[model samples]
Target: MTIQVDENEQEPWTVLRISGELDLVTSPLIRRRVHAAVAGGRHDVVLDLSAVRFCDSSGVGVLVAARRLMRSCGGRLRLILPARGAEDGAHVNRVLAALGVRRLFEVYEDVPAALDERTAPLSA
Candidate 1:
């Protein structure tokens, strides 16, 4: 399946809403987009993975790399991973958890909460 990534600005953060399968073939697209955003000076980023249906190790790697990149640049990275059963939940979330890397990211239930500076990440 084809992966679609839509980018938008939410004031202090740039949100990237990704949907479809996240595997070896499509993961590079995400990495490139994140890199481009960083290259363009956008540090605070929110990855909206609520719509994602599947995620593989490559996708997880990309996410970890993104987090690392943001930190290296002194920026922040957040993830939107809706709780299970909430509109199909977040497949990427499950993958990250299974891989034991979910705690590395600040995860929120939605974009609004992720963008809110006063909000806190959900437990991993």
Candidate 2:
């Protein structure tokens, strides 16, 4: 399946809400979007992956790259990977955790929390 990335702004954050499968075929799209955001001088980014149904190694790579890019530019990157329901189980979250890179990012359960500067990230 394909991926969908919707861009929005919430004050200091540029939120990118992503949905659909995140695999080799679609990882580049995400990477481009993140790069575009940074190139536009919008450093603080929020990637809402709560709606992502499937993810593979390439997807994880994109996430890690995004984190690295944001850091290199002195920006912050946050993720929204809600614990959705029991069945869904936050697919991207599980993928990141399994890869041992989940803790490398500041993750939030929702967009509001991700956009809130005063809120803390969820424990990895």
Candidate 3:
């Protein structure tokens, strides 16, 4: 399956809602988009992966890279991984957890929480 990334602005955050399968073939698209957002001076990023159905190692790599990029620029990176059903980004959560990198990201249940400065990330 293919991947789709839709960009939106939520004040201090650039929200990228990604859906579909994230594998070796489609991971580069996400990487480029994150880089573009950073290059455009948008540091605070929120990756809404709640709609993603599948994730592979390459996709996880891109996420880690994005995290690094944000940190390098003194920016914040948040991930939206709703704890709803299995298909709603749970796969990515599982993948990240299995890889022992879930704690490396700040995760939220939704966009509002991710955007809220007073809110705390979900425990890894």
Candidate 4:
């Protein structure tokens, strides 16, 4: 499947909803889109990965790099990952966990939660 990253703003956050598979071929597209968002002056970012069906190492690398970029700018980065039982568990979620990189991110179970400032992120 192809990847689609749409940049949108909701108050204080820039929501980037990513859909389709995220593998080596499509991951750089995602990375560039993310950099574009930040370069366009967006600091609070949320990656809505609920529609993602697969995530390879390249995808994970983009995620890690994005997190670092956000931190470097004193920006915020949140992620929407399916809960443990949803969609047999989100592909990116599993990939992050297996790679021991899940704890590096602020993950949420849904968009609403990720966007809500009052709601704390899920423990990694």
Rank by TM-score, descending?
3, 1, 2, 4
TM-score of each: 0.95, 0.94, 0.95, 0.94
Stretches of candidate 1 exceeding 4 Å from the true structure: none
lDDT over C-alpha atoms for residue 14 of model 3: 98
Give lDDT per model, in order.
0.90, 0.90, 0.93, 0.88
lDDT (Cα, tens digit) per residue for candidate 1, span 1-124: 5799999997778999998888899999999999999999999999999888888899899999999999999999999998855657467777788889999999999998988889989999
Tens digits of per-residue lDDT for model 4, 13-113 = 88989998889999999888889888988888999998998999899999999999999999999999997567733778888999999999999988889
All models, RMSD in angstroms: 1.2, 1.4, 1.3, 1.3
lDDT: which is higher, 2 or 3? 3
- Better candidate by lDDT, 2 or 4: 2
Best candidate, lDDT-wise? 3
In Å, residue 61's CA in model 4 sits off its true spot by 0.1
Tens digit of lDDT per residue, candidate 2, span 1-106? 4888899988789999998999999999999999999999999999999888899999899999999999999999999997634355388888888789988999
Q: Write the per-residue lDDT of candidate 3 for residues 55-85, one digit (tens) a residue.
A: 9999999999999999999999999996635
- Badly placed stretches (over 4 Å) of model 2 are none
Two-way TM-score contest, 1 vs 2, winner: 1
Q: In lDDT terms, how accurate is model 4?
A: 0.88
Model 4, runs deviating above 4 Å:
none
